[model samples]
Each structure stands twice: as structure tokens, then as C-alpha cells.
Target: MSFSSVPFFITFAENPELAICAEDSIKGARLVLKPFKNNLLALFNVDFVQGLFGLATSGNQLVIGAEDITLGAPLALQLLQPESGKLQRWDIFSAPGNIVSAADSCLAFGYRLRTKPPLQLTELNAPPFPQWIFLPFTTTQRGILESAV
Candidate 1:
């Protein structure tokens, strides 16, 4: 299957030779670890109840964000170690629209209530105890967050 430029597709951090992908459809989502080179040999695939829309690597663990198939249902973030077949899932409490990794942490982000700001960022590295971060948006212009080394 062809890969998209979205978070659903990513390269395995530990081994660049292998590609990490999540295919989402009406039938549900499937997470796969395979080589993107000459041939295709899937290392492992784990199915989810919803569409897996996010993929990231935090430390030695792989983080997957799943879409809420039903309205008002809490979203999920799955932590996986493909080589050992170890996997764990955590709920997001809120409906998250996307996921990304930064500062060595897996972050689930989306808009919350219409009354609140248009963005909500949550850290999932702690698992079960996600720290919520709110960025104050005053104007229509977006603020740029820069990290200085």
C-alpha cells in the first residue's frame, strides 16, 4: 500500500530500514511494521477499534493515536514495542484530532469546547496522567513555538 505524508505513516526510529504504518478505513485501523525497501514483510500488525490517525516514537516506545469512531467517545493512544509484541492503550478523555511527538514526548492534540481556545495539547508520556497544556489564542494569527538548543 502507498503511504501518505500524514502521521499515519512513519519510519521506524530504531531501524530506518523498516517502515511503521497505520492503515485506517471503515473496517477499522491496522498498525503494521514492515520494511519499505525492495520487498514487503510485515513484522507485526495490531488491529484497533477505530482509525489510527497518529504515529510517533517516544524513547523506545511507539505511540499510536486512534480516532473516535463514535461521537463523544474518548480517543485513545496506543503504546507499542513491535519487537516484543508489547502493547498498551490509554484513553484521551477528550476527542483528539491529531498526535505528534516533541521534547521526547508523545502529544495528543485537538480542539476542545467551542467556548475554549481552538487548540488543546496533552502529553501522554506519563500515561493515565496526561498533563494538559493550553495555549492562549488572542488573535487569528498563530503563535510560533521555537525550541532553542
Candidate 2:
């Protein structure tokens, strides 16, 4: 991924150390999932999430080798977005199919998740190396997408 494609959770940090480390340590992993529709999962495109990963597995991360995300195991995810200079947190039921288009800026994505923590990023513990499926988004792009919704 390009610098612009990095997620806001990895950027815009008060402590540059964590932000810098996250940026450099940032890795992409793919998910293998089956088709799903309606419900909260429908907001994202599962096929894209799998593609973001390397299409294979390396230690903790699984790379997407195919379009079907249903092939992989279900892992927990904490969705974080930049809000009021802080990251807003949500725990959503996300699978590979839950991921959608990520803008070049990597701040947001097209899919929405059912926040497990009720949209509180500060209250959540974002694991450093938890198995994840990420989608990059830009602030401008998110606005447009949200408007459509």
C-alpha cells in the first residue's frame, strides 16, 4: 500500500512514535470468505478485503488467494475512524466480504460494521498484531459515500 493508502488509525496520532511505528509495521492480509448479503455485513464488499491481504498467509495474517472470504476463520475486529482529532471505535461483525473500496488516502472504506464497543475507540484495545481485514479510506471519499447512504 502507498503512504496515502494507510488507514487513519495508523495515522493522525498524538504520539508520533506509535503512529510511525504503525505505519512502518503496517501489513496487509487477505481473508477468504463466502458470499453474504443484507444485515450489517452487506455494507462492505467481501471480495475486496481478501484482495488487500497478500493472497496468502504469513504467521498471523492470512493473505487472500481467492475472492471467497468465507474460507477463512472468523476473527474479531475493532473498526477505528478519525473523529474530532481522535479515533472513534466500533466493534463490528466483519468478515472478508465486509470490506469494500478503500480510497487512496486510506482513512475510511465503503463498508459499515456493527460496532461491538458502541463506537468508542478510546475504550477499546486495538491489538497490535491481531488478525485483521483492513480497507483504506479518505476523508473526502467517506463524505461522498456517507451521503449516498
Candidate 3:
């Protein structure tokens, strides 16, 4: 999938050589992985049951996260080893909007105000390596200074 197509996530900090994108096809959601720095490699696509909403990488392990509005908190997350063909699964309590790798084997992410902490990224021990996810912040509070003549 093209960058302009659907939502795209890459491991820029952890592994600049690899990247991933969520491809929505006529059938269902697909995970597309390939080399970002080199174009000689072919695109690797895998069929995913849940919608891949977020992507983060730690070392060679790729942490895949999904969002389910129907199921309040997230139940689990997937860890895929591309070369080894091994996938690890873990459970989480809450849901996270966007997930990024944090220091000390932690994942940090922001969730809506009403949502509870989904073991999502709150766990202290998770992922072998992590990537950085960044989003712009905004404040709603406004102040106007009044001038006295």
C-alpha cells in the first residue's frame, strides 16, 4: 500500500530498515511489511483477523495492536517474529489509541478520557524492543487578557 493510502506505521527509531502498513482489502485487514531503506526486497503481506491500528518494533519483534470499540479494553496483543515465523500473544486490560515503545521494556500510549487502562501499554514488562510513537498535543483552555483604559 502507498503511504497516502491508509494509515501507515514504521519503525523509524528502532529499525529504520523495516516498515509496516495496514492494507484494507476487499476481504479484510492485511499487514504489509518490507524493507524501508532498500527497494530490492519484496513486500511481505499477511492476513490479519483484527484491524491493525498501531505498529511498534523492538529489536526484531514487532508489536501489533488493534482497537475494538465493542470490547472496551484490549484483551491481547500480538508479537510477530518475521524471520523465525513465531508469533507471541499476550493479554491486555485496556485499549490504546496509538502505541509506542518506551524505555525499560515498557510501552507508552494515550487513550481517551473515559477509557480505562488497558494493560495495553501500561505494563511494566513487555516487548523485547520498542519504537517511538508521537502525536501533536492540543490544549482546550483559552484565556483572554482584558485591558483597562
The lDDT for every candidate, in the order shown, is: 0.31, 0.22, 0.29
Error of 3 at 85 (Å): 32
User: How many residue pairs clash in all the candidates, one count each?
Assistant: 0, 20, 6
Task: Score every model by TM-score.
Answer: 0.25, 0.16, 0.27
Model 1 clashes, total count: 0
Which candidate would rank higher by lDDT, 1 or 2?
1
lDDT of 3 by residue, 1-149 (tens): 11112223333244544444333221223334334332211122222222222232222123344332222233233444333122222222222322432221233332222344322343332343233322111111122112323
In order of lDDT, best first, we have 1, 3, 2
- Mark the 10 consecutive residues where model 2 has the least summed lDDT: 16-25
Winner by TM-score between candidate 2 and candidate 1? 1
Error of 2 at 79 (Å): 15
lDDT of 1 by residue, 28-114 (tens): 234444444322122122233222222322221334433332222232334543431222333323334223332212544333334
Best by lDDT: 1
Question: Sorted by TM-score, highest first, which candidate order results?
Answer: 3, 1, 2
